[model samples]
Target: MTGPRGRVFRTVSELGIHYRRSPACGVGSRSPRKGPRAGDRLPDLPRGLQARSSGPGWHLLVSGPPELWPDERIALVLRGRDDLVGVHRLGGESPWPDVVQGLVRSDGCLGFVARGADLEGLRAYLERWLPAQHG
Candidate 1:
């Protein structure tokens, strides 16, 4: 079936997947949502934590207790990326208990989510999506 924006879907599940994966679809602002997911816009940052203007790049938001923080390797990779604005350590409360890191696109949409400060998963995501040359 033809879905919104002229995209075709084989089933309702496909349509739901598309909706969950398309940040431009404006699903983040809608009601009856479960919680933030990849493709949803990053939720408003807590007070005193300003989001940097990434221009056309991405931003990494890391939250959780210090014991679950990202290590130096991840920091170095993010620091070397031209496509990444920088890593922002989120303070205050977090809505996601499983997610420790989020990758926010320049459009303010979340492109990836990492649980338990999983650096390997984060590295793989960067390699697949951002790539080294684009960094």
Candidate 2:
């Protein structure tokens, strides 16, 4: 799909095994009874990850680095997939539990939180994230 600047983006898919096309604006198509189709919104970020506004604007935070927190491996694996919308590196090494990197959907969409850390924050964010995106 073409974005605001005429940049093209690929649709989301399951490891390239199946693909879900994005709508014109990347907001997704509306469903008859369900409201927005499943393909309309970005899928949930893997567990233990949070995107939020930081001093620098937006940062992707993780519980820890992959070598420390097993959950951090999710981002590493996702970075290798072809079905992604966009990928960006953190650009520098940070100590354990610091903000790491960001992940976006097929529409170049990454989520943000006001403030969050660790699993507890992730859980809380999902509570709001799911309804805001899916509902």
- Lowest summed lDDT window (length 10), candidate 2: 26-35
Candidate 1 vs. true structure, TM-score:
0.60
Error of 2 at 48 (Å): 22
**C-alpha displacement of 76 in model 2, angstroms?**
17
- The candidate 1 region of ten consecutive residues with least summed lDDT is 24-33
Model 2 TM-score?
0.26
Writing each residue's lDDT as its tens digit, candidate 2 over 32-129 gives: 23211223332233422223221232233333234543545443433323232222332223222243323233332334221112334323333343
Each candidate's number of clashing pairs is: 1, 2
Q: After superposition, which runs of candidate 1 have C-alpha atoms over 4 Å from their true positions?
A: 1-19, 22-34, 45-56
Colliding pairs, model 1? 82-135
Report, for every candidate in turn, its global Cα lDDT versus the true structure.
0.55, 0.30
Instruction: Estimate the lDDT of model 2.
Output: 0.30
The Cα RMSD in angstroms, rounded to one decimal, for candidate 1 relative to the true structure is 9.4
TM-scores for every candidate against the unseen true structure: 0.60, 0.26
